[model samples]
Target: MSTQQSNRVTAVYRTTTLLAYQGNPLIEALPPLNSFIEDLSALRGSLKCTPEEIHLNGVERAHSICRVIDDFFQPLSQHIQLHERISLMIRGGYVGRNPDTGDWARHIQNGYERVLSGDLKAIKFTEVNSTAQSMTLIGCSGNGKTTAMKQLLSLYPQVIYHPNMNLEQVVYLKIDCSHDGSLKEICQNFFRAMDRALETSNYEKQYSMRKRLSIETLLAAMAQVANAHALGVLIIDEIQHLSRSRSGGSEKMLNFFVTLVNTIGLPVILVGTPRARKIFEADMRSARRGSGLGALFWDPMDEGREWKALTDKLWSLQWLQKRDEVLSGEIRALWYDLSQGVLDIVVKLFVLCQLRAIATKVERITPKLMKQVYEDELRPVHPMLAALRSDDPEEIIKFSDLKLSDTDKRLLELQQRVALSTQQTPEEFAYQQLRTDEERRVYMALKDDFNSKLLAPIIRQIFDQNPSLTWIRLLPLVHEYLNNPELSKPKDNPKKPKSTGRKASVKQTEWHTLDSDDLRFIYSQTDSNSEIYPAISKSGLVLNIQSLLEEAS
Candidate 1:
């Protein structure tokens, strides 16, 4: 038999032996979930601006807020699902196996020989069966699809060297579909990406620079390079750019993707805004092929659990002078109305409102203030937001992809204005003077000394009571209160306790001694018509300790 035929026989023999020896031959090859999560968990981004940072002037504050915006990410249910889906795709796609054709053994054997020979063109293989899958993620702009994917993919090492196989495996490759949408350009892009990843300009020089090369020739080169590197997945972002009028058409572009999966056995993930939906809808075969892992259509967040969770977390990051930490119903309602639950709008509106609050010295984010910000600062996005608010699918689609160019420009202007104005504000200058390092140290120390929840309001009250006193001068009074806790407590007439028949206020104690009935009564008082007992019972609240202990038995 020839070398290729001989290798095929060897592969079959090894496969049979492995199957007989082990119940599951591919079990050891699967990527470990624990390791993936451990690696991924570290990749999550976070931003927290302290009180001092919040107190900074406009330009500084704007810069800091922008950083927060850039760093902020709240992983939702869809994020978890997307991560798992991609992981599954990678695991299935990179298993180097196809039970239908029994090609796994041949692939492994050929790959080893190719590595040993150190000849890129020596390996000869046929595409009989492919186990590659494709996934399409369609979402509105700024829904965090790209950001989440970047973070998720960052967990995996870009280039993994399998010492035993002597192979360099690229776990994933991401490329943006150019505006031209030319197949030739895409093929060149693929080569350039590979060149960057491998630290070699061979492909770029060999394929891309050659103007005479046919699209087909470039595509063949791309397939060879992809298989040579053992590419795990190919992610094409901004797929909407593949306009039929500009490129050979969406059909041709999609055909290329199908070819990749069917022949090269490389999984693909296409990510784009809602505009790309037209491309997939144009060809049923392409749509069906792309839905191998199922299509994930991410709409704007509804006023549901995910929306509440996202807003609640973002609300907690407030650094305003008048901190409305509680997410009031009115504020939430106004927020949803203004943003229509689009995450990008929600975050931008929040940052702009904070800036407005600081600029106007209102120092709080109220319903009126939020509305004013949305009307004045976010006028550029008003049309898009209105379309979303209309709940008309066609209207939404028309406006969904609208870029926020004007609004962004306006925000920059606002930042500059705030920075300039902050310097001239006498109160800000006075506040800045009082904010010495020692004063901050004392404030932080006292914050730790007292209940963190109570300290801010107490300090605000102290400042308000003695407006003339500088922060440094006020430090002694704060220390005195801390040193003598009894002096800080409100004095009550000694005879009043004897005169009143009722017990001290329930708020006085921290609920350590409150009975279940008393807690239920308090809960009922908070919402008079609501059934507290049933809710408490559903929550597994037990009135009696001995009864609960007996139930555990």
Candidate 2:
């Protein structure tokens, strides 16, 4: 069948036999391509397992590949100009489904009988009511309300098939809610929002004159800019900032939102903290008429089997490969506990671990290494977590308003590691559990004398004596050295140049290695100045590699 003919048949089936067509196609036009597309989406949806669960099943590569294919399709190439084609959905309209969530979970601004919201299933308004409806995304931080809103901004199944775009489409504008709080600041933000949309649309030069203007009249001129780019959704993130302490900020901003949407007939997306509900409630009348508010609250994920599942998904990311070797289960679980299933924390934890693994030339990710990361890299995370755990809502509010200092940020990461690691037994605790001659000696030094430094050297001496022992065999030695701070301590993450003209100090740790390659790569980085340490063969090795690493970092 011709593409046009097939679409007509499918559209008729979709409208008349919606159920029969749903979950299944209106028409299975072909077998091979059709089934490949079908099965791929099924895997994606069921595979909605968290990073941890996916890691346990070893499926990160599959997920990434699917994402890449979806992103590059028509939605991307024609993003800036899709609004011009806006018209009524005629015969044979294509309704795409989310591969990850399948038909039931497919994204739709106008919820329908078959489509529903996750956990927030309140209403399913018709498509006719949705032509360009304004939406309000409400929720608390970390509850995933904001993240879901951002994710929903994109198309379901990632790609929209055979998208037809006119020369004039949408310009998406985002105004950060937590930014400078004032009526003037709001206008400035609108200007910046326009510039950002221009940048995204690759229409920078054409809008340069508007970008340079700082005149007061420029505020009212934002409408022209929106019309120029065919503005789409104007997302205002962190809307609760208005209530944070700006005089009449809410009223003025709400009025501006009203002007932008009601005056121009454009859709706006409002994202804010749970506290934002107070603002919306105060002006519920205006908000209702302005944009139907949909609250999305974000909080730390619930603790449950999903925790394990999320942890497993992260374990198998391609970056976890040791010398390009796949990551093992023991290492994966260690990473999970240290990261506590937080996406941001998990990614950083892994990156820190990977950089260390590369520098050390460790052949694999091990629980002990993750502990080293906790001490060296993640130690900084403690203070932020302290703030989060603080009982004072006022302090949380204050702290949330402030950016983290270098030391405080690092401490917060440490706290996250501690929280996540609660899922796994610490090395010290496990060692204490096992009683042997070596364990007893290390324990007594730490508990009785607190001679950790003295004990570490002794443990190091043992490893030096039997250097050929495998990591499994060297477990006793590792236990002793880990306890002995003097001989074996946590390694520091590489840092910037110091002004004092001090020589770079690379702290060496007597670590447990399960294999020979692991030990060799580690020792290779160290200097052989009677001290086994990583050596810099700067002249022979690639210096440009460090530049690339710096750029990427």
Model 2, range 64-146, lDDT digits (tens) per residue? Answer: 32342123111111112121121111001222221122321222322222122222122333222222445565533433343
**Candidate 2: minimum summed lDDT over ten consecutive residues — where?**
1-10
RMSD of each: 12.7, 20.2
The Cα local distance difference test for each model comes to 0.66, 0.41
Worst 10 residues of 1 by lDDT: 1-10
lDDT of 1 by residue, 1-553 (tens): 1010110011111122233223322323323443334544455455776889766555677687666567777766677678777776776675555422456555545444444554323345665356788889988876777877877776555665545555566768898888747777777898898878777899899989999976666776677677766677888888877767756777877777887776567788999888888888889987786577878888878898888888888887776665666887768988998898888888888988877766665556766678888889889888888888788988878876777777777677777767876776443343332323444444565764675444544555555455454555556667666566677642332432222222223332233223333553335323334655654654366477888789999
Predicted structure with the largest TM-score when compared to the true one: 1
Please give the lDDT score for candidate 2: 0.41
lDDT, model 1:
0.66
